[model samples]
Target: MSKVEITTQNNTKKITLSGHFTAMDHDQFRAILDDLQSGEGCTACAVDLEHLEFIDSGGLGMLLLLRDACIKQKLALSLTNAKGDVLRILDIAKFDQLFKVVG
Candidate 1:
């Protein structure tokens, strides 16, 4: 949650996050999560984590929250381009059971 960029076009929404996702960025991420949960717009969503440098337990929690929101709203959500430590952390958390991840 170092930097977050969100874009929407043609009913598709994408959120790109870079740097570190940890407790320090909780507030910022929660805002984004809230927007998604509202789901006033956007038919599909993807989180691009190709440039993410790090992640912690708090970050994982945010991810779970996102998954739940998407499910509740019935929106298609996925994570893409995860690798290195980011990928490892997600694997350790068995996030594959919760969200569609592609690299």
Candidate 2:
């Protein structure tokens, strides 16, 4: 399972993911989406994957759910600092096309 840490600053919500991300993380992820939805007037949401060690398809789905939530909230969504296995998985999955990716 993954650990999610969320913080907001300068109208941006940053979500940091660590450990392995998979279906098991769904319970925690819901709170994340709720947070995003409730961030009124937020300009962006950034998902930081720098410390994430691994991700499964279920994790990818959760990201997609986050994307949709961002869209409805008019928040720009970005995936940042992905590297190693996490980066490769995202690239192979074409996440770059779905979200703004930054290092």
Candidate 3:
């Protein structure tokens, strides 16, 4: 299971992902995308994975989808605060080449 929260400030949207992220979270994550698409004035998005404990390939795919959406919207996308297993997974996937990652 996973927990997701979204908040926006100063024209940036912050997406917080915690616990486990797998294919099962697809629907939940889609809803998040819908919310983002319907809103306006967001110039950037930061995905916060500080509390995320695990992420599977599906989770990585989801991030890619989000990145695509951000690009279409001309919004900057960044992955932030990833650590432990989550950070390791991102590294293995070479996501740093895809998004700006901040420690």
**Local distance difference test scores for all models:** 0.86, 0.94, 0.93
Can you tell me which runs of candidate 3 are displaced by over 4 Å? none
- Which pairs in model 1 have colliding backbones? none
TM-score for each model: 0.90, 0.97, 0.97
lDDT of 2 at 86: 93
User: What is the C-alpha local distance difference test score of candidate 3?
Assistant: 0.93
Q: After superposing candidate 2 on the true structure, give the runs of residues whose Cα lies further than 4 Å from its correct spot.
A: none
Deviation from native of the Cα of residue 4 in model 2, angstroms: 0.5
Model 2 vs. true fold: TM: 0.97
Comparing 1 and 2 by lDDT, which wins? Answer: 2
- Candidate 2 residues 6-102, lDDT tens each? 9998999999999999999998999999888789768999999989999999999999999999999999999999999999999999998999999
Quote model 1's TM-score.
0.90
Task: State the lDDT of candidate 3 residue by residue for 26-47, as single tens digits.
Answer: 9999998888886599899999
Cα lDDT for residue 50, candidate 3: 90
